[model samples]
Target chain A: MRHPSYLLACLYLLSLSACTSVTIDEYQRAEASLASGDRIVLLGRRHSPDYETEPDLINCVGKVISANQSGISVIPEKQFVDELYPWFEPRMAPMRPERLEYLMKQPQVREKIEDLKLRYVIWIDGSTQQTGSAGSVGCAVGPGGGGCFGFGTWDDKSDYEAEVWDYQKQDLVAKVSADAKGTSYMPALVVPIPLLARVQSNACKGLGAQLREIFVPDSSANAGA
Target chain B: MKKQLSRSLLMLSSLILAACSSQLTVKGQFPSPLTTAMPLHGAAYYSPELISHSYAEDDEDRVKWNIQTGAAQQEFFDSLLPALFQQWAGHSPDPEGEAFKLPGVDIIVKPTLSDFQYSLPRETRSKIFEVWIKYNMQLYQNDGQLLADWFITAYGKTPSGFMQSDEAAMNEAIIVALRDLGANLTVNFSRVPELQDWMGKRDSSVQQQSADRGGVQNETP
Candidate 1:
């Protein structure tokens, strides 16, 4: 009976732990870039870039790219991979600057890049890793049946950064970053309850919002209050 | 009296655990690959006894069970493999191929369940209920020629805090296994020498048709 309260307290404390977010850095239109307006990178420029209507704009953009169909070129992940085959390797994604620079030199590559009509090459990259976990668990197994007993905690940190490369200028311009930490627990005294980290998803959304800000040009954020 | 009370408590716990056992099933196929229908013959054989019918828990090394869930190896294998095969290979013209004798059956797959278990392993201060399955696949030509025979093992693990139940873990593991199985068949189907020869012998136009289809695979054998 007392154990449940103790576990709840632990969970409460864990949830209270601080969460980090992405910082949308300063960026400018590359000299070679096309002039465009607010549109989510996920949904291409078919719909109008109406930011007020989509309050959940931050949630819409998964990593860095705005998913609005109107402003950003929303190339399907499959199509992007297939069309840019030999170049757009999904396994080896977030192509290195040097590699991208080399590819931009090729006429055919440049033609394809222009063909995609990508104004800003948004590279959203990051991963969540379990940094540390500590605790002990023991289970009792017998003919009657088996159950686990023990308490443990796992530490996980999600670190992600988004980089926007201007293909026209052939230069890296904007960078946004987010980092958050979380903990998971196993309180399997009689019954088990697991509290996994809320790190990666938070980092993704946090970073995504900042990237959207840069693309959407938030007047509220820019205006001096 | 204490012993009696403990027994009663154990019985009550067993009932509750049984109720908590999940009913998991794989629904729908991924997507059909082949344009044409190929008759796949034979049933995937899973010994229910080999894998305990109820939920079993392996604590790192020790294995024990107390709850009996509705999940069965045969039910899972029967429902999943056909649809999986369709997605990976193409189409199974005859999903229900009859016995040892069937007409127009070019390829037959005999799948035997080797090892199936859900375990909770302690790693880096976390308990992961790892569901794993090992199965042997025997690919044979219609003329009873063994084209290829191999074993595949696949697993799915969820941390102690995230996993629903052993049955759920088992279901995920099954899906992973079948996914692997489908990929195995698709990539290796054309590589079977016996199948190639049999198809060529049955119809001389088979090679010509394949050539016309421009079917070139990376792993030809």
Candidate 2:
């Protein structure tokens, strides 16, 4: 009974609204996989002179440990016996396939590790580049008592990027790379606040979740015991 | 009446735009750099020469002990040693607000200026500050027997125009290196096992609490 023009307008509105509903497939998969018992290990390394590997690895592992609620046991890959036991020797042994298999077959090792619901190994390698763009704008305000004066303000924008990788089945399963941008406005009368770092932090956290999903498929097959 | 309404609408729009355009600012004052002071000792020693290989030269350059003393070199040490000490002091877990006591019986900062070279390849490489600060610190007795001997290097690069800033840069580099060294020293002093055990217990408790609350049992102790 509605007019044709109204119907067309309604349809247009619906179509426009559809564009805003982002189907975040990555987040959904990560959440689903995490709900099921799946063990994941994070092996983080940095190939840059500026970065320290241990702290970043610890942070990434902390994120993984915090995200999942299942019986998932997130371990640092370096802590595995095959990696640590070599320290006792005069020289470290090379990571041979036979040695790996033997280590995997050990009863104590198998018993403690077999109960792991799922195993996910993630590697993060990236650098942080900080760049900013600034601009100024002027505004006029009428006097509250009589007339208004004018004020100038400055604004800035910052961007960040992260490079990540996931290894599964002893192969490179997936790779995730992301960038985030944010802006900060400083009034002429006030001090400037650094807002870009906050935006970048949020982006990195979101990327972490996305990386989890890409590396771990949301299927019973990948579920931990 | 229509004209008045239009004027009011325009004013409302202007108000909205003004409100949207304005920026929020915060003001705070940081502590003055000078208010905080670092403890100083009378004299520090250095090894004879720095040992480094130059990319341009085939041979390794090693300066002997007696050749490494001067006003310029002293200036370099003045900047470097304090920076290192400050870095250690910042992260030292000796409880905040207490005087910084050297962990060992005697604190000795033994600096070595190795690979000190000034060359001109493209432009004039007037002054290149490359040196290593090796702390041969002993906890007990002043006889140079060290409880901990931390070897750290501070590298500095200066352009012709910025040659004067070399001392400051060297100082900053030494501070960073010493901060790292101090962290290592603290870790070694505390012994990683005790810290690991504490961290493990904390992790276990956290996991247990999470399990009890039925929140998320994803973490393993």
Candidate 3:
């Protein structure tokens, strides 16, 4: 018979390897495609007092979108924010298409946008949170040795929405939302084994893929403008 | 064996104690604002107190934090002023001086730190370290008449990640707050009512001077 410790290890490892579930929902207004030299920028929403959409997630989506040979170019969030400075700051950033229109009226701003060849601005808003947690892990150190023992588990949920704005057109063209959920486990024998779920990463991939579909449809027949 | 054990225990206790206190210097670089400078010569004065600002907080849990951000604040304004005005000059800090009389200086600006506050993840029951900074900006005419006095507030927060040190998180928060401050100042400089009135007068004076010169030149021609 297998020892209980071995069984626990096997069981926990199996559970930790469980996959995360991600769902993507998209709403497109007609169709849109990127032309040569057209670039896109992904910015995180920070106006919310309680939470901030993490920059890492934005970078992840940007990378995923450009990963495929779709000729989709993405501007780094930091570079874009820096180039635009004060205008895209949390307080002054336009949260709506109408506000963006007003901002584009400024000659300086309009000129800079044109120079950047920026076609789309994707505003990402959302955060990953530990929805629920149970169990506990305790650690103790003594003269002889130190070790941690216990079982802990927590659930994480990531919900994000990306709003695509056609900068030249000064309007919202598409909206893509991603939701991902997973459970993480930590089972400690002599040392704690943390099995973390890629909850936010999964959400990012889903959002990125759906955004790609908007510009580069799955098939040429599916392409629309 | 017993002696070795005692040594180990003492070392462990010392390590735990060391983790309770955090001290860090906030450091960051500010990007030059990408806007057309106003057609005015400006001077900024950074007081000694504002350039040496620091905050310390101690709690019953023996958690001690000391954050130094004065240097960063000085750098932020130093980089921003030059880019925000057509002509910019920084003079020696003088707390008692009422007015500045420098050649071609149209406006004088003084920024002071009013308040600073922070919350740790444990206190807020969240995995985020947050900071808030309040500043009071005073704009003056070359002759010391106060043109505008207003408050600018900025906030920053970073979520705690596994294996991330408190110092790193707090530093990130401060950087974010500083960037926010720059953004607010740049975007809203003319939005202040008093400053708007001053700009209106300044613009009209320039227009009157141009018209007078034009009339003279036209008559001579």
Instruction: Flag regions of model 1 displaced more than 4 Å.
Output: A1-156, A161-177, A181-202, A210-225, B1-100, B117-129, B143-145, B155-170, B200-221
Which residue ranges in model 3 land beyond 4 Å of their true spot? A1-16, A140-147, A219-225, B1-17, B58-62, B92-100, B202-221
- Model 2 Cα lDDT, one tens digit per residue, A176-199: 554444444332322222222343
Q: Candidates ranked by TM-score, best first? A: 3, 1, 2
TM-score of model 1 (first chain only): 0.63
Name the better of 1 and 2 by DockQ: 1
Top TM-score model: 3
- The interface root mean square deviation of candidate 3 comes to 1.5
How displaced is residue B9 in candidate 3, in Å?
12
CAPRI quality of model 1: incorrect
Comparison by TM-score, 2 against 3, better one: 3
Candidate 1, residue B144: CA error in Å?
Answer: 4.2
Highest-scoring model, DockQ = 3
Please write out the lDDT profile of model 3 over residues A88-168, one tens digit for every residue: 988779989768788787777888888889999999999999899999999999999999999999999999999999887
* Model 1, span B189-212: residue lDDT tens: 555566566656767686677776
Ranked by DockQ from best down, the candidates are 3, 1, 2
